[model samples]
Target: MEKTLYVASLFFLCFWTKAQENKPYNYFVQESKIVDSGNTIEVNKKGDTVFVAHYKRQDLINTSNQDFIKTYKGTPFFKNGWYRGKVQTGTGMEWEFVMAYNIQKEEIYLSNNPNMEATVMKPVSFTMEGHTFRQYKNQYYEVIYEGGSQIWKEYGCSLIFSNSSQRTGYEAEGGDEYDGEFLKTVKYYLKEGDRLREIPSKNRLFKLFGSKSNDVKNYAKTEGLNLSKEINLVSLFRYYDSL
Candidate 1:
C-alpha cells in the first residue's frame, strides 16, 4: 500500500509540472517578424520560438558628456527619417540595431540606448502609472548628452486589447524630422495566438506603415494586395506559402 501511494504522488507531481508549462495565456500579438544583417525570419503565430526579438538583456552606455551635433557634425541622426536604436544587455554592452517591438502593461515598447562616453542632455528618468509595473511597464527612454542634444533614442508602443478575444492591434511613432515634413501615426489589426507568427521573409507592408488609409492602400497596391483584408495566423501562413 505504501509503495502504491508513493507512485501515485510522483505521477501527480509530473502531471502538474507539465500543466504549468503549457498554461494558456493570451499574447496580444500573434507573432512578429524582424530583420537584421540581411537575415529575416518570421516568428509565426505560435509563440513556440522567438526568432527576432531581444527580450531580457540590459546594458547602459553613458552619453552624458558628448554633444550630438558636434559628433555627427549636425547631420542629424537621420536623413530619410527612419527609426532605429541599439540593443543593450545588463552588462552595459551594445548590440546591433533592428526594428523591434516589446510589451509594457500588455503593450509594445521600442527603444535604443546611447553608446558609452556620450554626453547626456539632462538628468534622464522615467515614470509609469502603476507601481506593480515598475520594471514590467518600463518604456524605452531617451538618452541625452551634455550639450542638450540627443545622442540616441528609444521608443515604446502598446497594443490596446479588445473586449472580444478575436482582435488585437497596436500603434507607434518615433523618428527624426527633415525637409519640412513630420510623420507619426497609429494602426490596429486582428491576430490569434494559436497560429505560428514569425517575421515575414521580407518586412510586411503593414509593419512599415501607419494608420493612414491612403499610405496603407498605396503600400498594399505596390505589393499587389489590398489593405482592408482581415488576417489571422492560418491565413497569413497560407498567403506566405503561396508566395
Candidate 2:
C-alpha cells in the first residue's frame, strides 16, 4: 500500500509541472492599440482592424477571437459649422478616427494616418446674413492636415480650418480665402490671435431660422467648417521640405 501511495504522489507532481509549462498568454486592449504580454498574437499591419476575444474558462472553448468595436463622437471647430465625427475608444482611449478637410471644394474628408482615402462626407449647408453655402454634391471637403508647422504651408487662396477654436479671420492656408456655408463673406482670414468666432451670427440664426443662437455658436466653436460646394495632390515631399 505504501508503494502505491508513492506512485500516486509522483503522478500528481508531473501533472502540476506540465500545467505550469503551458500557461496561456495574457493580452490587454487600449483604444485602437493592442498589447499582448504572452506574445501569442501579432499585428501584420498598421490601421488594420482585427478581432479580439476574452477568455473566462481554461479550455479552448473558454477563449474567443470575437470582434469588439467602440464608438466616439467629436465636435468640429472650423469656420464652416458644427459636425458630428466618429471615434472609437476600445480598451483604452489610444485610437481615434480623424476627419481631414479640403478647402478647394469646401468639404470634410475622413481618413486614417499613412493612407489618405476619401470614405465619407458630412454634408454641410446653411445661410448666414443672407449668404448661402451648400455642399451641392459636386464640391467636397477634403481634410489635408499634416502635423507640425507644416500647416502654415497649407494656406493659399483656398479656405482651411484653423485646427483650433480660438482662431478666427482666415489667412490663406490652401487658398487665398475660405468659401462655404458657415462663413458669411467669401474673403476672410483665420488668424492665430483672432477671437473664437462662428457663422450665422448666433442672434441672427435664432431670429431668422428660429434655431438656438448660442447653440449654433457653441457647436461652431467646437467644430469648424459648415457644408458647402468643394473642389488636391498632397505632396508630402514638398510639405516636408517647406518645414
Candidate 3:
C-alpha cells in the first residue's frame, strides 16, 4: 500500500510540474530594460508568457530631440501616411494615437497632428494600417504568424548619400539635392524560445519546417501558394498550426 501511494504521489508531482510550465500569462512590455541590445522574448514550449524588452544604440528616445522632418524621395515609413494605432505603455495602459514608423531612423512617432512628429518615449507595440508590429533590436518586426512559436517580418532601409564622389563631369550635377530614395528591404524570422532564426530564402523556410516539410509542400502545391509573398507565408503557418 505504501509503494502504491508513493507511485501516485510521483505521478501527481509530475503533473503539477507540467501544469506550472504550461500556465498561461500575459506579457508586460518594458521599454527601458532590454536584452541583447534589442527587443527580446522568452518563448516556452507552449509559447505562453512572452517576456518582452527592447534596446538600441541610438540616443535615448525623447520628444524634445526635435529636428524638423525632411522630405525623402520615397516614404521612410512602413506605412506611407499617418494611421490610427494603439500603443501600450509599460504600465499596461493602452491608448489610441496617430502613429507612423520611420524605418530608416528606426523610430516610432505618434502625434495628434499628422503633419508633425515626435518620438515615442517608450518601447511599444503598435499597428500600422492593418498590420501589427513590435520592436526587435533596433528595428520593428511585424507579427506575421503566432502559435507555439512566432514568425516576424522586419522592414529595413538604408541611406544613399549623394554620389558626388562618383560623378565624372561636375560635382554640382553628381547627385541631386535629394538625400537618396528609400529602397525597401524585408526579412523573415522564426522565433522559438530564445532562438530567433532567419528564413532567408524559400528553400530554407521549407527545410526549417522539419517533420512538417512534406505537408507544407503538399499544402502549398494544392493551394497554389507562393511562399515568397508575406500573406501566403502567414497562411502556411496558420495551416501548420491547425494540423
Candidate 4:
C-alpha cells in the first residue's frame, strides 16, 4: 500500500514538472515607455500568447503586414517615428506598447517587436508620446486641451500632384503621374459637450471669447506667449475654463 502511494506521488510530480516546462510564451506590455513585468494571456503572432495587465482574456484580431508604405510620399503618420503609447482596445483592455498612427490610413501600427506585423486594435482612445487622441465621429483628433471647454486638433494628409515637371511629352508619360508631395493639414475644434465647432481662422480664435478677449491678451502678454501657436492656446484654455 505504501509503494502504491509513493508511485502516485511520483506521477503527480512528473506531470507538474512537465506542465511547468511547457509553459506558453507571454509578450510583455510596454507602459509609459517601459516594458514592465507581465500578466494575462492574449493572442499575438499566431499561437503565441501575450501577457498583459487589467484584462480578462481579450483577443487581438486582424493580423497582417503593412503593404502600403511604398506608395506614399514621406509617411501619413502623425509622428514620423514610433513611440511608446497606451491604447484602450474595444474590449476595454488598455495595452501600453510602441505604436505609430498613420493619419492617411487611419490605422494604428503595433511596433517595436521583431515579429510585429499585425494591428487588430480598434482603439477606443490612445495616448502616445505625450499626446492624447480620441475618436470624434470615427475620426481621430488630438486632444490638445481638455477642461470645462476643450480644444481638439485634427490631422490629415493629402497627396498633391507636381505641376512643374522637368520631363515633357513621352518622357513624362508615367514620370510625374504618381509623383506628388504629401501635404499635412491641422485643424482645430472647440468642444463644449457633444458639439464640436470648427475654429475657422486663427485670427478669430481669441475673438470668439468676446468678453474674455482682454483676459487672454493679458495672459499671453504676461507669459510672453505667442497666442498664434496652437499649443500655447492650451494655457489660455486653462485660464478660460477656470472662469
Among all candidates shown, the one with the greatest lDDT? 4
Estimate, for each residue in 117-151, the C-alpha lDDT of model 3 and write its tens digit: 23343355776678888766656788878886689
Candidate 2 lDDT over residue span 1-243, tens digit each? 698657654743554455446444222222223232222111224532222222232235857443322211111223322233442222122212344333433444333432322333433532222323333234422223334311111211222232322112343355322121122223211112332112232234333222343554454445442323111112321232343
10 residues in a row with least lDDT, candidate 1: 67-76
lDDT of 4 by residue, 1-243 (tens): 698667655743554455346434122211122222223234444543322232222224645321111122344456655678888755455666677787766677554452443343447799898888888788899888878878889998765544433221245245433234456788888986798888755557777677987887677778987766876778877887776
Indicate the worst ten consecutive residues by lDDT in candidate 3.
25-34
Candidate closest to the true structure, highest TM-score: 3
Give the candidates in order of lDDT, highest first: 4, 3, 2, 1
lDDT of each: 0.28, 0.30, 0.59, 0.60
RMSD of each: 23.8, 25.2, 17.4, 16.3
lDDT of 1 at 191: 27
TM-score of 2: 0.17
Q: Comparing candidate 2 with candidate 3, which one achieves the higher lDDT? A: 3
- The estimated TM-scores of all candidates read 0.20, 0.17, 0.61, 0.58
Give the clashing pairs for model 4: none
Q: Residue 104, candidate 2: how far off, in angstroms?
A: 2.9
The best-first sequence of candidates by TM-score reads: 3, 4, 1, 2
lDDT of 1 by residue, 188-209 (tens): 2222233212223233634522
